[model samples]
Target: VTQRLCNQIAGKLNSRPRKRLGFFTPQEYIHAHL
Candidate 1:
């Protein structure tokens, strides 16, 4: 159970950065388009 919880936390931590990066890229793209 502890291992599973740890893995879930790790997965969220990893994906959080990726999600932020994706949002940033789109915002940059819109700025460039404008």
Candidate 2:
């Protein structure tokens, strides 16, 4: 896959909220920890 496509996929995954984090996006959860 192209680098652009890889980045797009990662962005989408990171932006999705997960039940594991009280419905917070992965990025949001990470930023909170930091």
Candidate 3:
């Protein structure tokens, strides 16, 4: 249950694009920075 919920949150954070990130998802933003 805890693991499942954490997976859901991680999925959203990795997949959702943000305006503050110039419309890039968290994963993309991290790669772009590095």
Candidate 4:
């Protein structure tokens, strides 16, 4: 159970940057915007 929870949390963290940029990776969006 703990391992499953950790995996879910890790996945969320890994995807957070993309979500923050409206589904674009943060670096990709920033470069495009600039």
Candidate 5:
């Protein structure tokens, strides 16, 4: 895939919060816990 496509996917994944992660985005979870 193109770099642009990968970046888009990564952005979406990172922007959306997950219920399993206590409704926090992955980045937020990492920052709070790590």
Candidate 6:
């Protein structure tokens, strides 16, 4: 895969809410912690 594709995938994954995080996206969780 190209670098651009990898970034797109990462962005999508990070923007998705996970049940383990109380339905918060990864980005939201990181910002809250930081």
RMSD of each: 7.8, 1.2, 1.6, 4.8, 1.0, 1.1
lDDT of 5 by residue, 1-34 (tens): 9999999999999999999999999999999998
List candidate 2 stretches off by more than 4 Å: none
Query: Which of the two, 2 or 3, has more TM-score?
Result: 2
* Candidate rank order under TM-score: 6, 5, 2, 3, 4, 1
Q: Provide the overall lDDT of each model, using Cα atoms, as 2-decimal numbers.
A: 0.62, 0.94, 0.92, 0.76, 0.96, 0.94
Residue 19 CA displacement from its true place in model 6, Å? 0.2
Best by lDDT: 5
- Candidate 2 per-residue lDDT, tens place, 1-34, comes to 9999999999999899999998999888989999
Model 4, 1-34: lDDT tens digits are 6999999988777656676688876566878899
- Judge candidate 1 at residue 8 and give its lDDT: 97
TM-score per candidate, in order? 0.45, 0.78, 0.66, 0.46, 0.78, 0.79
Query: Per-residue lDDT for 1-34 in model 1, tens only?
Result: 6999999987766544335456445545556678
What lDDT is reached at residue 21 by model 3? 94
Q: Which consecutive 10 residues in model 6 have the weakest lDDT in total?
A: 22-31
lDDT of 3 by residue, 1-34 (tens): 6999999988988799999999999889999999
Clashing pairs in 4: none
In Å, residue 17's CA in model 3 sits off its true spot by 0.2
Model 2 poorest ten-residue lDDT run: 22-31
Comparison by lDDT, 1 against 3, better one:
3
